[model samples]
Target chain A: MSTGATGRIEITDLGIEFSRNGRTVEAVRAFTLMTTPGEIVALLGPSGCGKTTVLNAVAGFVAPTAGQVAVDGEAVAAPGADRGVVFQQHSLFPWKTVLGNVEFGLKMRGVGKAARTAQARTYLSLVGLIGFEHAYPGELSGGMQQRVGIARVLVNRPRVMLMDEPFGALDAQTRLTMQELLLSVWREVRTTILFVTHDIDEALFLADRVAVMTARPGQIRDLVAVKLARPRAATVIATPEFMALKARILTQVREESVRALSGRRP
Target chain B: MAPAPDGGWQRPVRRVLSIGFFFVVWHYSTKWDVDLYVRFQNIPTPWEVLEEAAAQLRGAAFYGHILASLERIWLGFAVATVLGIALGLLIGWFRLAEDTLFPPIELLRPIPAVAWVPLSIMLWPTERSSIVFITTLGAFFPIVLNTVHGVEGIDRQLVRAATSLGAGSAAIFREVVIPGALPSIVTGLSVGMGVSWICLISAEMISGQFGVGYFTWVAYGIVKYSQVVVGMLTIGVLGMLSSALIRLVGWRCMPWLPRRVKDGG
Candidate 1:
């Protein structure tokens, strides 16, 4: 069984397609990535570059037309509790209180009420929403709602966390703060996280390695490793290393976006 | 003060005032002092109707008629709610059932609750059961339709989120589907309850041996203007009270739901 310091995920040559009005659209084309345990990898690309499709395939929401997605030596044939996902829209159930949303996973696992509440409370605290456990999701601000989304995934302690532009909806300032918050949480848990984003600075700030993808027919263009020091903060965005990484990623994104707009294949 | 966007309480107050104004206009119009076929004695004033209603309240017959009508409405309304919510959840969730059953229900929905009265009377042995059946038919469609729509309209992400978190099918339905669709379900029930009252009054009028409808019909036959007015007021007050009760139930169950414009004000 795969375990301990190295949280491994191996995806080989994945392809996904969407059927629209009897026409087949190629959404993902021959994507591939491999990372050892405890590594945070960002799938970075432009808006139309099919970055989210790859993450969905990994999370088991979408099936790849070809190839495989394996996490910690096990084939991801279906969505399991092992791979937690945070959606871009902050999909906290509006009817449920914050604690109920956090406790949902434990309940699904058939954990006792006592045990689940204890687990949920710990997770709520991790996301800095300890006092607001009984509050419903609708009462929260956008940033706070996203924090609930984050805490929900973290509590499950999955082998891999598949996040689809988790901080995309936040303002620039809040985004930076959330990025730092995520870094601190990731530092403690050391979970292998597959984070998806179109933001260049975000890709550099949070991920250990950034996997750049091409247009519609997305595939790994480059795997640039970001070896910045631990415990990253908002200030990390201003550093020379961060800017250098951001510049490289922006070039890749601009090329991909141009390719998409031209109505040409990459 | 530039009151809140919707002077929150004013709409209800306005609705009540409008209804009162209409009655006042109706009462003044009924004063056939100029030229009318029916005399002022036939079309009584609002004050005359209120006086008759107050006088009738002293009698047990009026209360008895009210109780009978209330009993049938509560019964049929209750039956429809239980069946509608359950069947709605099933039809809403399963595509095959939705396709098969929904078409027939949609076709039948346009048929008035009163239209079902003759068929129900022919089918049922007892008057009470027929009344209940017609009322159920009346209330059933709105509640079922709304519940299904509510369930269908649930945020897809919420279902995906709960399922991804490892919730089983049962938990998904209970914690996610039901609560998520609650706003819609309650809407259906409130409408169903209102419809039930409409059907109950009609049904009572058609086959009532001892209800408000029977009393009103008999009064009209004998040209008892005061009794007719009394019966009409009883039905109106009872209908309004029942609807208010249903709305109160909706409020207590779903404080999270947005409050809409109230009726009659």
Candidate 2:
């Protein structure tokens, strides 16, 4: 994969809090991560560990209470096309056709009709959604919808593609297919990506480095770089190197999951 | 028997039978001069009412009455649609607009449109303008309220996604807020269409000299019971047809919505 020159993401000492039910709840604290241009990093943790909060901070959907997020040294104060996000579900505009949804960022930048349409079609074809341009999001299956979501994000050629469990809602078979699809697309586009998920296999399969996170008010517990060979297939999971890394990361995640469960009880 | 499958001929057959049963009961009641406490004794027979409807259809004056009422409803409904949607979008989207505008609308809304007849008559000089004003008043609240609800109920995630996709505030409003609120806006329109008819008819009965409502009221005063029934039926048919037109138009505009399943189901 040829890495793009400009897609670096830097998040430093980020903290986030939410005021819910009249209480200030700390969701994430003292979290820091950075990626080289076109590197894939997965923030792996149990649900509610504020793994998503960190991703949201980078995507400019959430403001950090302590630190800041930067893309290519430019600080992110608000959401922009520079950081494209693929949400877990229901992110597609139900009213817009698949083509329209993919064309949205280009349209916002005032690209002409012919140029935007051609560009959108290219991205759609990349994600294997070439024939379904005119169909609405409501008509597509869950897997196809997320394909549109991925295409929509990639069409922007974003500096960082932030995925918050983008395939979390899909069935196992679909999720595997989507992971493969994402890797192939990432290889071609080579945009920086920050993926957040709780699934161990997903984290190991898709990411260059998996940053295991602590319980709520989360921080990185471990960052394990996968040394497995590239051009990975589904069969790579059975390899000793992949399994050893999974075993190491699995213990950290299990410990965090236990802490997260106990922390919620009282 | 088990329920007929959906989209079957049995359902249509049952619907036809249901209407036929009502008409049969009506024809028999009037023919028998059934004098319950409610009194069907003075009520016109179905045949007599049909004949009177045919007679009215033959007259130029009846057409004039129908046209006058229609013109008032069309003018009032059109005005209400434009203003209600504009005001609703504003009020629903921007908090400042909501705070500044919503209070007065909320205060004024509960006063029924029929109650506005006296104020409307005093406000506008022409009878036509007065009737239209009342009709507009009736239709406005529902349209504005439904639109506000629609806008408010839009998923915040959609807005976030749009913003992250490089939508400015104005672009978000046009692309996201407006379309997201459309189904509800169409609901408002359907309701507004119904309310406007009610207001028009009441206004015409009370003050108009040239509408179907006015003709019906006059027929009652002159003791033309069969013609009164005809007028009532004409109003009913027109109201039904207009509401259907709104639905048809709404359905056409929202082609992206799934056909088999109703929205919010």
Candidate 3:
């Protein structure tokens, strides 16, 4: 399969704020990042640290209050097919069959029935959901539904895939399996991915570079490159290098987590 | 544990027994010379009603009355469904439409369809149209309101997902909004069907020349109490069958709903 060239993402000093109950709350601030085409960049932060907000901005769901986000030098304005987003939960259209959900984007783009169905079937098989094509989202397990969500976006062949804790609601075993599945799929598709997650291991396992974010007024605090060998297995978590990296990132994450819990903004 | 061997037969048996109990009570209560119950003295026994129903069912004129009532219901319900769904979708999806269209509807909704009898009679040139108009009014509100609630209650993320997937407004409405609101819409249709029957019967009784409702009224006017009961039972059975038909269509449309819910569990 010939995978097309995916676009690069550039986030320059991005900031987002929301006004709630007559109070302006800064969700993200001076959050600068860059992702080369096909790079898996994970934004790792404590809960409510606004890391998802950054992904939302990149997805063009939210406008930055400061700075800018661009894909392939094109300014972000509104959500488009070039950028596909997989939400944490309830992403798939429940009313649609698994095949229908996968074909949704192509259908929206006016792709013909025969072409879209063939393409949808390809992605469905890629996600290991071939026999379950007629099943509705409600009938599937959470992991299966999320896989459908992934297939739905991957069929679009987006330049950038924005995932907001896509496996957050899964069990530990399912999460690990999903992470592995994501890695294998990413290797094939090689689309630029900005994955947001609270799990340190998940961030370390899936991303080329894990960008640790601070709490409240979230900003990128550290960018740690994972230099583990290619085709890294789940056993990599037991390796010395992986352990050292996890320990280092844990300390920084713990401090930000404490600050977040105490209602301190920095 | 597995179900009992007789489980399949149990429900039907119980249902027949339940219905038999009602007839038994009616027979004993309205027995001739049973002065113990003065209130039941004037009413016909179940046997007398059954005999009258058999005689009526044999007559060609009885079928005409049934067909007339059915025709009026079909026309009014069809009109209500089209208008209700269109207006509901518009009001539910668009803020401007909601603001402008909803207030008047809400104001008129509280007024019973029966109350519209005088206005309907004057507005339409024929009695049939007037009766249909009243029936339409009865079915309209439930369908419209439920559809509005269904649309409003749709998950925002579904809309966002469709948008991100390159869906325009029309595509989103067609794929996401319609299917998402369907369960509620089906509920509305069912309720609308029931209410339409109520309004249809009332309108027919008041002004209809040939209908089951009119037949019942004529029987009562002539003190033929057994035929009146027969007409009432026919209406009840017809209303039930129509409601079940609506539910059957709902089940077919929403294959995504669980089997239990689809089967009316």
Candidate 4:
């Protein structure tokens, strides 16, 4: 038995449009989506593909111009403790130490100082940052910083974890280590994760299902389930099923990109 | 890398040589009997100024005058700081206050504190209290202006982070807003010290019975040029000391703000 049988996230016919600089940008075009219980769903797309925008919509950062989003049975009206979000840029407050950042969500949830510190330390151990509790975010390397970022989001034990390009900023070696670290993290909590990324390999490696999206004014073209076995290791990268899914997602992305460049409506 | 000067008696030799150059020039010019006001013409000689300053320094009245002026400066500065920071934060945080209070403050800020000399005199019957009032007004405007700028300059993200973390208004202000606004508060303090120093001198001349400003002004009335020079030097020393004290207090309060430069400016 693996840690992959718990929470759920549901998104229905969501749409978002914004007016910036006097121009109407249809940032999200009639996005309809869902991720079932205990599943890691990856929103795969290129830059300007509205992958982040869709994540924002679901996270309650943006008002949907069209549809509905629900976690378990409740509709999200604003950012809350129940749905933890890790931004693409790692928006950890610079003034706080590693422990402080990890304890932020817990503190907001009204947990006592003693209990929050203890729980935060537990999550820190899970992410291999147990010893660096007092270190500031600026004092750590990019990968170490992101590990704190993951640890900060994970400790809350949210029903749904919304991540936007969580590893897009790391170096290649760091990215791979982070991918392994993320797998171990998922194996522990198995919270319903909607992880957004442009990296096909990362999506293949972690996600139980990958929803590859069409380019800007973005729409979901396909949501393919990755049936790869869990306790998935770094060596999973060399497997046939991994490579095969990579090829399929690549084709979907490239086709959508061409259609996007051709000025044809996606 | 600046090494120590090569000569064993370097600093003492340099100091003596500079003084020697000045006296030699003065003594020679006086000895040659140049028709021009050579050594003590309109400006007194260095020796004469020192002698008069030493004589004044020995007097109890001189210390009393210095103490009087110093008292006014501190009192006015203390009052200005609390009022300025409170008003600045209010204007910065609330849109209604910015609209209602700031325009009036801007109108009053440009009027010189000296102009308030007559106004303060009319408002208060006593000369000593009047001088204090003017000095307070002088320091108040700059403190308020800088504080408002500082409060407005706070990072928006920090505010959002606090609110999202469930911090109420009081905690947000005490834990976040004050510390975040401290660097700017220090800037305001430094500027206000300078302005108060300037206003204190003028206020002293107008209303003081015995102070450095009054001593200097009174000396000008009688033509004791050497004593006037001494009084001017005293004011400069006092001003420097006061500014240093202001910066010391600032440094103590805002330990997070970097201390790379002492703009004792």
DockQ (C-alpha based) per candidate is 0.62, 0.88, 0.75, 0.22
lDDT of 4: 0.79
Model 1 agreement with the true structure over A1-266: per-residue lDDT tens digits? 24455458888989999998998889888888998888899998878778888888887888889999888788887776788889987599877789888888888888999999999998888878999988877788888899899889878888888889989998988888888888888878888899999888888888889999888888888999999887786788799988888888888889888988886544
Report the candidate with higher DockQ, 1 versus 3: 3
Residue A169 displacement (Å), model 3:
1.2
Q: Give the least accurate 10-residue stretch of model 1 chain A, judged by summed lDDT.
A: A1-10
The top-ranked prediction according to DockQ is 2
Per-residue lDDT value at A27 in model 4: 77
| Model 3 CA deviation exceeding 4 Å by range | A1-5, A264-266, B1-12, B32-38
Instruction: Tell me how far the alpha carbon of residue B190 in candidate 3 is from the true structure, in angstroms, after superposition.
Output: 0.5
lDDT tens readout by residue for model 4, B1-265: 2345667897778999999998877655544545664343466666777789889878888888888888888888888888888888888777899999999999988899988988898999887788888878888888888778877887764554444444457766765677666767778888888888788889878767867889888888899988888888889998888778878878777543334533432
Instruction: Give the lDDT of residue A136 in candidate 4.
Output: 71
lDDT of each candidate versus the true structure? 0.84, 0.92, 0.91, 0.79
Off-target runs (Cα >4 Å) in candidate 1 are A1-3, A264-266, B1-27, B30-41, B258-265
A57-169 in candidate 2: lDDT tens per residue? 88888898998789999999999999999999999999999999999999999999999999999999999999999999999999999999989998888988999999999
The count of residue-pair clashes in candidate 3 stands at 0
lDDT of 2 by residue, B47-96 (tens): 99989999989989999999999999999999999999999999999999
Poorest 10 consecutive residues of model 4 chain A by lDDT?
Answer: A1-10
* Chain A TM-score by candidate, in order: 0.95, 0.97, 0.97, 0.93
Model 3 C-alpha lDDT per residue in residues B1-265, reported as the tens digit of each score: 3334767988779989999999888888788536764578779998898899899988999999999999999999999999999899899999999999999999999999989989999999999999999999999999999999999989999998998898889998999999988988998999999999999999888888988899999999999999999999999999999999999889889988987666551
TM-score sort, best first: 2, 3, 1, 4
